[model samples]
Target: MKKRYLASALVLFSIGSLFVGVSAISPLEVFDLTEDQLHILTASRFPRLISILLAGASISVCGLIMQQLTRNKFVSPTTAGTMDSARLGVLVSLMIFTSASPLQKMSIAFIFALLGTFVFMKILDRIKFKDVIFVPLVGLMFGNIISSITTFFAYKNDLIQNMSAWMQGDFSLIVSGRYELMYISIPVMILAYIFANKFTIAGMGEDFSTSLGLNYRTVVNLGLIIVAFVASSVLLTVGMIPFLGLIIPNIVSIYQGDHLKKNLPHTALLGALFVLVCDIIGRVVIYPYELPISLTVGVIGSGIFAYLLIRRKAYEV
Candidate 1:
């Protein structure tokens, strides 16, 4: 959990990711690279690495912010309908704006994701029953409903193949020309860092934040917008990587404590490290073939999630 250790691991994994694919770009040959090697390095491997780091860091930070604002360790974009709604928005873009560019599709996805997150918050406010676990379950069910609607329309329009492309997280498709939109997350992450202290205040509850001269509602909304945009952009670019956000932040908080400002950097580093490791495993587990990121993360992340739930319950008892 030490920053240096996490940074060290991140650097090692990043360098490893650069050399892992079936392209035969060995570190040993880098000093005497061929023309095709250089092109592959510049075009494919580096872009995939960058997209992986950005998606991992931004999504984890997004989850950390949401957990703080909502006071639920379990809440994240995956559970909150944000990703599903964004996928629906993608379908809408393809259906209505057939000639829409990727950026335009992302714009539509961002709007729907924001609206979906807003609706989740509204429902959160009205719920008379509030169990830490149950709240996110509600969110998961809501997300499923949106996913079902997306699926229904996808089947009707014969766009299931298109829509399914974004359902699973895969890095195989990312290359230099295709992944620039994920860069949007860099500035959004900066905004999160700037507002970190206010987010901490907002997490302390509305009355407490108001007493301290903060506009609690504004800060919460700002956090949601950050989550929505990051989630949408990542989905637009790399597809849905479930539980990266939820698990990474919780792991950071356990070791680093709950102060949003203090833990942001650690969360970012650990998130990137986790994704890099998972991605490398995905690449090598089958040797020359790969697993989709969604599968690897879902398989591993769900186990960690289950353990966390049991641990939390034990401590509460």
Candidate 2:
């Protein structure tokens, strides 16, 4: 949880991620590398590693923002219909824009993801019951409905195969030219850090923010826009990596406390470290073969989610 320890872990795993693939590259080979090895390092390894780090850090920070705005630790893109709606937007893009560019596709996805998240927030406003756990359950149901609609349309239009590719998160296909879209997350993350204090104030509740002369609605909307963009960008680039956002922030808050500004750095570092470690395990568990990141993260994240739920329940009792 300390900055020094987290930084050390991030550096170690990032370096390890660079060398764990099918390519036979080593740290010592850095000084003298053949053309083939250099190509492998630059074309595949480096890009994949960069995507993993950005996707992990960006999504986890987005999760922290959502939790702050919603005042619930469990809310994230995964549970809040953001990712599902982004996938739906992707399907719509494939159907309408046969030759859509990456940026165009991401734009559409961002719009839909934002809309879905906004609708969920509206529902939250209307509900009188503010159960800690039930709000996200409703969000889950909403996302499932959107996913079902996307699947139905995908089947009718025969785009199910293409849609399936974006259903799971995998970095195996990442190459230098293919993964540049993920860079969009870098600026979004910076903006998140910049607005950290406002988000902290916003999370204290709208009435509290109003008392402090903050424009609560504007801050909340800005936070959602950030979440939507990051969710859309990652979905467009790497597909859905469930619970990376949800669990990482919660874990960070456990050690770092609930202040968004204080917790941001740890959340980002831990998220990247978690993904890098999972990706390495996926690469080696069946040598020369690979497991998709979604599966690996899903298995581990779901276990952590269950534990968190149990802990929350125990506290209630």
Candidate 3:
């Protein structure tokens, strides 16, 4: 019943998104759209909606996978250096392949993201006792080191201005051709769904999964690949949407429970709904001008993160 509400709300917001921009179009006028209005709907609004749904769903699922595998509620791409590494990869592309297409940039970013995440997992392996807060804090420190390197290179090569485009997530610029790369995450997410049970067992820790006849290392590597791939696609397409993968899964786990397969659909829907709400808020906040989706989501996600931190013990994550 609650799931129905979530799905209905998502549908409603999706329709509402089509009419929220500077160009005036109404639900009532849909059948009578002027050529300009039709173009706006087809070109900008629809693309933005699809990007939002894809990004929100994919990133949120990535966070869920991270938390499960690490056995830490706070772990996510935002904290774990994945986004920072991708940004660095993008900077490298701009410096070397000045005429690089979006696909080239995404491919490079995926490789760097995968490597960075692998390094973090190795760091996780070194920690004898993984304090819940301590683990992600280490990741944050690692990400900051990566960010510092990215900034240094950007300044050295005079590419800081180019790098700024990826500093925040925005949907206003999305149009047909540019956003198709985000579709890559769709098939990747289906792969995640296929491996959900293995992921669930892998989350039970190395000894437990091994005793249960699961190849723990293989599952963990597969999980990291999914996370890195999804993070790269989203960063390439939407820029950085912080705390998205972190908060959405925790929220769903509260209501839907921790089974990855059971929670996947709920997490995806709620994530899309949350991002759509934030995007709508960003659009309407100043009437003609708009806030960045990063700003709006950051403000809200941080508040919720604070609440979750306060109640972390109750959640036992």
Candidate 4:
């Protein structure tokens, strides 16, 4: 399994590097580059590629951390109302701080994302559902409610057009200045790595982690903070890329085990690979035009999500 994963990682990385600027660089000319080609690669394609890779890997790792902290496989930013709440934060920023700087918008989005995630955790504590699958279902419903509210306000305030523009994730618009915010994921990812052992123990259940002399609540809060920060950064920089979080960790765990630290690197690699492949497909599927990353990931992820649902007859709570 390790060999297969390593091979898969190599293939995906090669493909990602190959297809990134295929339109401009011919297969034969890939070795011999002109100044223009070099410029395009360095200034445009490289930044966008790095952004997608980092965003994909970070969000996937964030999902893994969320699942471990919550002891639920199905929970993610999308399912747990974090993304919708973040979107709401963006919307509110547009309304109230129309002239706000990018940093200000990010701060607002981060706060709301954290608040929404905390709310979901509280709700999980209150609900006595026997099936763990049902937990995410309830979370999805809560997310929908939050999304509806955001949409309503956006529509009434004439900000829907702006909101719509940001609702879909696209790499075409990513240039040098535009994608720097995504680099925030680097520190958050490192923090996840640093606290990985705590997350693993926390996943065992609150009682066990507490008995082990770990402050379970503080660790869980720290994990959620990382999630919220990553979610907000991605949403601000490239719009919402759906299901990259939900799918990558689940896929990695099938091969690697549920240990957060053990699977983190694999999860990050696979997530970047998945997004790169999907982005390439989106670019080619429409020819000169392009499809949003959100759409490509959404379609593929929905299929995976359905399979997961059908495969599991019951979930351990």
lDDT by residue (1-317, candidate 3, tens digit) is 28899999999999999899888788999989899998998889999999999999999999999999999989999899989998999998999999999999999999999999999999999999999899999999999999999999999999898788898899989998989999999999999999999999999999999999999999999999999999999998989998999999999988778899988888889999999999999999997889889999999999999998988867675
Candidate 3 TM-score, true structure as reference = 0.98
Candidate 4: residue 255 lDDT (0-100)? 77
**Residue 151 miss distance in model 3 (angstroms):** 0.2
Better of 1 and 4 by TM-score: 1
Q: Rate the local accuracy (lDDT) of all candidates.
A: 0.94, 0.94, 0.93, 0.86
Candidate 4 has a TM-score of 0.93
Each prediction's TM-score versus the true structure: 0.99, 0.98, 0.98, 0.93
After aligning candidate 1 to the native by TM-score, how far in Å is the CA of 273 from where it should be? Answer: 0.5
Model 1 pairs in collision: none
Residue pairs that clash (backbone atoms under 3 angstroms), model 4: none
